[model samples]
Target: MKFAVDPWDPTYGTSLGTELGESAAQVALDVELPSSEWQPIDPDPWVVPPDAVLFVDGVRRVDAQVWVDDGGAEAAPALCASYAAGVVCCCKDGAHLLTADVRRGLFTTADAADDVRTTAGTYRATRTAPHPDVAPAQLLSLALQRELADTELAAAAAARGGHDSVHGGADDLLVIDGPLRGRQHLPRAIGFVKSHRSDYLPPQLGGVVAALRTGQRTPVFRLGSSWERHTWYLRLPCRPGAPWAGVVRVECSADLSAGEAVGHAARSQATLPRFASTEYKDSRAPQNLYPIAGLERELRRRLGEPNLLYRALRRAAAA
Candidate 1:
């Protein structure tokens, strides 16, 4: 037997986890092609990419974990997180940042908790009610993510509206760097998932994903979780290694027809590979496209220094 290393840096975790569990989402594999005909589809060289490609990403940092002094017998645990979202637009002229927004929040279920105003930044109090199904920390994290998602949507809208003057009336493609759960309503938008945690496809179709070569993609399929979306798998350019190296899942809103989803899938083949990052430049290369990497760095910078923010929070608490 032969073993191959996954190109993703170990610190970030493997691109594909070993504990592949079946997805709870209802999956329809025949949206674009019959299961019997499943195989990697080569990119259509003739399909021209959109005139402009917008890359949207968000970064969040937990500045500190604190205990809320609510009037209850015991204090409630809360998290102070700083999150920022941004968009980078790539067109015939060049790639440049379009919009970026930063937000800070105190997430807790304590009814008495108020907005946190520190010297560094003000974290608006976000009430995240406890869920029996989820942990408190995870609930706080999810609340932070929801704020980030909203910021991302705003950034995307601002970018699109602000750039039309510079890029003319040319068509654009919106690429969200993670799952498209909340942002699926955006037009011409596709979710760019860099890694996999669940096995959404059956073993027969999973073989198709493993067999994909650079610049190739699997046929579009539908995934229904809490929300529904059409998705496909594409292999980005990367050094030969793991069977799933450079693989990423691309998805679009289920509101689109199957043919339209297929069109987006084909257009992705012509578009995304151009921005694929090399291992030398990115720890999550290929999957983490260049524009997205730069946007993430910028967003994190906008989030401010974590240590400074933490100290500010501590000082505020002391006062």
Candidate 2:
């Protein structure tokens, strides 16, 4: 028997799981190369790294769960959530936070729900009609996630607007810390997925991903279903471990030509490994790049103290 220890801390869960469900989306393996020709592609040494790399991420917390009384037969359930999004730009001058936006929201389905104000902060009421497919709590959580995504978009835009002022005539690449679902319209942006939940490729193709060496990537493939995007897997620099250790999935808008997607794949291989974190520094090292880890800390800090916020909510409810 043979086995390998996953470098990622167990508390955070393994980077890749053995039980992966098949993805619902349709995958086209021929986008960059036919399935028969699948293999690891090394980084293009000629592919120049962007002058600046913008790392975007968001953090959210459920401060408290509350009930909203709106004169209805039954009280409506609501959640008080604090979420924040931000961007950090890395360039010749070094990494600096470019933009950060913190927001609080009372997510509920109650029509009479209004903005919640507390000494700690205000959670503007965000009403979403209940859906049969989702539970109330899950719906509220989804609403909070959507708000965070929107904030991330705005923060990225703000960062791009001001980026040139700091580094004149510099080309920049935008790396969003999650799926590019709603934000695919952004130019020069790619989603950096740190973990795997679904098996998007067949065993033969998956072997290619596992075979990828540090700073190498699989051929680009198109995933289509509810959404469409070009995606590939890359391995970050890390000690030898599990077959799938140090792997990360990168995605770009499907609007790009296959050649363009391949170019982005090359660029990612050439660039992202430089920011890979070490096990001693991060529980989710390698896949969770250094800038993103730092940005997450800053964003969580901006969310304020959860205990104090919860106390304030309690007081507001009593009043």
Residues 1-319 of candidate 2: C-alpha lDDT, one tens digit per residue: 8888888888877778768878889999999889999999988879999999999999999999999997989999999999999999998889999999999999999999999999998999999999999989889888888898999999988888888776674798999998988889888999999889899998867889888888889999999989999999999999986889999999999999999999988999878999999989998888889999999999999999999999999999999
- Candidate 2: minimum summed lDDT over ten consecutive residues — where? 161-170
* Displacement of the residue 6 alpha carbon in candidate 2, Å: 1.2
TM-score of 2: 0.97
TM-score of each: 0.96, 0.97
Candidate 1 lDDT over 3-38, as tens digits, reads 998889889988998887788999999999899999
**Regions of model 2 farther than 4 Å from truth:** none
Show where candidate 1 strays beyond 4 Å.
none
Per-model tally of clashing residue pairs: 0, 0
